[model samples]
Target: MSEYFNTQALALSKSFADAAFKAHTLAVEGLERVTNLNLKALETNVAATVDFLSEAAEVRDFDSLKTIFPKGVNLVKDSAEKFYANGQEVFGVTVKTGEALSQIAKGSFEVANDSFKKQVSAAQADFSKQVNGAAKKATR
Candidate 1:
């Protein structure tokens, strides 16, 4: 009886540990993806800023100013579009990670519940057998 209990306990512990590890791995991967996306965005922003500054510095007359103004407007529009796209990518990663974590939790719960039901059924059968044996001996 003790051995059976010990085995069940070990199985339950291992299941919990495995689920936790999976969750941790998913979370770390999601974070890494987001970090990479942000880094790339930052690099692009810096390069764009430097290029725009270089162009603006060369302005020496109205003709140069006219050309720089249109380029500056285009730069702002492009930057906004890039920012929106990066935000969507981050959100996608977050949603996927959350779904994976939820699946882990659901699977763990189902395993534990099934184990509990089996243990209860076994205990009930053992108790019934003992009771029947005691009644027969008393009658004899």
Candidate 2:
């Protein structure tokens, strides 16, 4: 009985550890994806700003200024769209990671619950057998 309990305890411990590791891995991967997306967005934004500045610096007359103004406006619009898209991507990663973590937790809980039920049923059966044997001996 002691050995059985020790084995069960070890198994449960390993199960929990495995679940934890999986959750951690998923979270890290999601974070990595978000970081990469942000970095890319930053790079694009910086490049666009630099280009716009360079264009403005080249302005020599009112006509050139008019062209640069429209370009600047377009840049702002494009940047806003990119920002929104990046936000959506990050949200998607977060939701996916959360769902995966939830699944890991749920699976661990179910496994532990089933193990506990089996142990209880076995213990009850063993107790019942012992009681019947004792009663028979007493009658004899």
The prediction achieving the highest TM-score against the true structure is 2
Name every residue pair that clashes in candidate 2: none
Model 1 TM-score on a 0 to 1 scale: 0.85
> How many pairs of residues in model 2 come into backbone collision?
0
The number of the candidate with the highest lDDT is 2
Segments of candidate 1 deviating more than 4 angstroms: 1-10
lDDT of 2 by residue, 1-140 (tens): 56557767877898899999999999999999999999999999999999899989999999999878989999999999999999999999899999999999999989987887787688778879989999999999
Q: TM-scores across all candidates?
A: 0.85, 0.88
RMSD (CA, Å), candidate 1 to true, equals: 2.2
Cα-based lDDT for every prediction: 0.90, 0.91
Q: Write the per-residue lDDT of candidate 1 for residues 1-140, one digit (tens) a residue.
A: 56557767887898899999999998999999999998999899889989999989999999999989999999999999999999999999899899999999999989977886787688778878989999999999
Superposed on all Cα atoms, the candidates' RMSDs to the truth, in angstroms, are 2.2, 1.9
